[model samples]
Target chain A: MDLLLILFETGFWAATVRMATPLLFGTLGELICERAGVLNLGIEGIMAAGCMAGWTWVYFGGDLWTGVLFAAFVGACFGLLHAIFTVHLGLSQHVTGLGITMLGAALSSFVFRMLLPNITTPPKIIPFAPVKIPVLSDIPVVGEILFRQSPMTMLALVAVVAVAYVLKKTPAGLALCMTGENPSAVESQGLSVFAIRTTAVVIGSAFMAVGGAFLTLSAFDAFYIGMVNGRGWICIALVVFASWNPGKALVGTLIFAAFDALQMRVQQQTAVALPYQFYLMMPYIFSIVALIVMSRRSAYPKALLVPFRKGER
Target chain B: MRLEPRAHTSMAMTILVPVGAAALALMSCSVLILWAGASPFLALTLLVKGSLGSVFALSETLTRTIPLIFTGLAAAVAFRAKLWNIGAEGQFYLGACAATWLGTGAIDLPPPLLIPLLFAAGAIAGGLWLLGPTLLKTRLAVDEVVTTLLLNFVVLLFVNWLVFGPWKDPMAMGWPQAEPVVDAALLPPLVAKTRLHGGLLIAVFAAVLFWVVMKYTTWGYEIRAVGNNQAGATFAGIPIDRVVIRTALLSGGIAGCAGVSELLGVKGYLTLDLSPGFGYSGIVVAMLAGLHPLGVLLSALFIAALSIGADSMSRALNISNYIADIATAISLLAVLAGMMLTRYRIRFR
Candidate 1:
């Protein structure tokens, strides 16, 4: 009974929160980018860059906020680089995104080594302390999980709400949506498709960087090699699972986070007799299965991966 | 709104383009070396010497090239059929897993019997792994690129699970790896003392066989036709859907050979980090080779030389090992940009 209780409570719920945090940030970024009609496959690389940048900044300066801001700035720079390739240079979006990812990975490792040479121990920052809302702290299990997260979680929640509002209610959001769905139509209305996409790319990438920064600054506080650990890719999958809706993406991210958390929890107590590798494989396998099922019913943006050229309908 | 047609560059100019791009790439790579506080000239010399200076270096380079050759061929085959198989890394991992399972659990045969069975198992595992994405592309009209790339993470996680969970060596301490396979299951050494093995021969043979099929086989012609134009091929009575599926599966299977090479040739055991982006590097190789099987062989060798030489340069000159990766990236960018010169002439208005 104690073993079962440990498996159900701490293993499942705590793991879920830990797993969900990075995915939440990543998927939200992807959701915004895809909704704008430019698929940023460079999320993986960008997140890694953010992890290194954020960790390095916090390590030296001892300011987590500054680290996050620097990460966002770095992400925006890469976003501009991606925009140059896809928007101005007329390169394939997929190829450009892949190049950006490679560049990000290369740059991260290069910078990490240069900054922290001959370091026997990895430097760690004091992670953000969890905040409990006054009234919300009195609530049940939901309140504990939702309100008792670090400031980054609160930032993520705020960003989701803000993103959903902008995507649905704002004129800029409509223009961005039009640019993604039908660039020619958007352009015909005398709006700059390039401007809308560039903005979307920059903003979307900032979110991804923040997600990465959160990993280093808030979650673990020490950046390791390949620290993003496929969370950027997980975000992409979540975007698809959510049907490109920020709200749905939140749910999707949580589900995946829950799976990850459960896997960790199960490994702790279960004598399931099977190789633990099978359990570790659960989240990825589940994501693929989710993708396969979602692909059967989901509706993607019409011009998702297509680069828009002027006067080409 | 009218534009004048530009004159086509001469054949000599076209040839010079790649050479010029390569020179530019070299200059760009020098910047990285300079940043690392190493003399560009010294670094380049060390790189070349480390890759090809001695018989041992050459053997090491060949050992590195073996898996790349398979992955490059895999990417090339899929690209030729216009079905992007970005999940070559995952397929490679799955292949390694299957080979490990067969070599350790299922097969108890002699060296001759076991080796072939392991290779076969690896290929079939890779092929089956690719089947889901291919089906999605053909039946659901889903994009294969995203699906294949996504599957890579899934396979990576699965491989991690295996090594860390069930396949953890029973006798060994807490290091996350499987037990090394029996001597009967290992690939025979190609050289006297070096790490080079029979996998290089398999890679060469696979490349040559692919080249022949692509040049002479009817199916190959159909595949190229479909890649050139799906509608045109369909109208011409080619089995377009079947060709896509077959090509994807074939690519996945060939890529799986990389797993076999790694397991039997290099590490002699399965670990989580078995691949250092061999699948992704295959993209650069495929692009550099212009999707040609024979060209993939050469590109794979070049890339392998760079990787091996990079390590040597790091040891000899104290340059960061990443300088080599930067060089490879620059070369890939240059080659890809150089290929553009074949189709379009850049002009300033």
Candidate 2:
């Protein structure tokens, strides 16, 4: 009973929230892109680029926020490249996205080696620290778990609300959604589906970049190869799990993060003979299960991977 | 300018597109080399010399090409049916595990029986690894993309658990590796004083078989029809579901062979990082070949040479080897961009 209570302690919840912060950013970014009819598989590479850009900037005396902004800019550039390929040139989404990811990963590694050659110890920067909200953080368990959090975590929550609002109550969001569902309908409504999709890809990629930046800036201080480590891929699955809803994406991210945090805690504390790698595999397994259950009936956008050419049926 | 579909694409343009893309990619990659503080010309020359200049270099390049050929054929076969088996990486690992299990067993089987058994074990394991996703895709109509991709992570973790827990060698001190396979299980080297092995023959034979089957077989005709237009194929009485399942099995089985070849023919034991993204690279090769089985042979060799050359280029230029990956990626993108030119013509508005 005491062990169970320990598992549910304030620290665990805090860790869960911290873990979910990056996924929250990534999921929302993917949601925006998918909602606009472009499946950006370049998330993996874009995130890696963001990780490197942010780490390099912060390592070289740039302000942390500046590093974050730079990462977002780089991510947006990748998004632009994706848009030019899938949107304008009408290439295969799978091929183009995968290509960008390969390029981004290679570029990041190459640049990292050039910048920090032959270091015995991995380089580090002072990461973002938790800030306690006045009066709110003093209010017992809730305050300890939620009120005392990093700036990035706070921004993640705000983003959820902002995205939900934009998606539900705005004309632009409706256009974006329509483009994914039926480009013909969107075209009949006198809106440029191309412009909306491009905008969504750029903005969505910026969010993904910020998510990557959060990993290097908030999750840890050092940039390493494979650091993004399929998190972007997880977000892609989460978008399906959440059924293209931003609010549900937040919930899904939290659930995945909670499993991760719990697994780490259990591996550290339990005397069980099970391999610790299974603990690491929990979130991925859960996502797969969720996909198996929900994918058949999942409300994917109709024109999600289809390229739109003007005046074509 | 606006792009319009061509009534019939010319054969000359089909060959011209990828080469043009390669040249374009080479030009862009030079900018990256310039950023790395090296002369692009020097780096390019070094790459060619290092990958193909000497007999030894050519041998190493061919050695790399061995696994790629298997994987490329894996993708080519499945893509021909329009099935995306993204779990080739997972299948490779699973196949390796099976080969390792059989190879390290106590039975003192003769070389002929033991070698073929190991190969068969790998093929079976790879097919089984893909069974779940294939069933889900065919039966429930679930998107194989997400399922297959996610399975890669799951199977990788499974392999990690095996190496770290049940299969960890007691003699290696702390390195994560399984016990070495029996000497009979190891592939015979093809060349003296080179790492080239008999597995290259298997890869070549598989590529030839794929080309022959895809070109001459009735099943191949049906698969091509289904890939081009599923509804049309169904209307013409092709068993689409059966085709999908069969294709997935063969695709995964060939990928499994790639893993076993790497294990028995090269590494000789199960270890982490065995693939080095061979599965993902297979997709690149498949696309570069325009999903043709015969073309896969040439594309895989091209890609293998590029990576092998990148190592020597990096050593000579004092730059990161990742430059090769960038060059490969740029080439892939350029191919996609140029591919449009073969199928469509741009007209000034």
**Candidate whose lDDT is highest:** 2
> Which lDDT tens digits does candidate 1 get at residues B4-91?
2346657775556555655676688788778878898998888889999999999999999999999999989998888888899998
DockQ of each: 0.38, 0.72
- Model 2 over residues B318-337: C-alpha lDDT tens digits? 88888878888888898888
Model 2 accuracy (lDDT, Cα): 0.88
lDDT of each: 0.81, 0.88
Which portions of model 1 show Cα errors greater than 4 Å?
A1-18, A133-143, A272-274, B1-26, B102-117, B157-186
Note the residue pairs that clash in candidate 1: A275-B166, A276-B166, A277-B161, A277-B162
lDDT of 2 by residue, A58-86 (tens): 99999888999999999999999999999
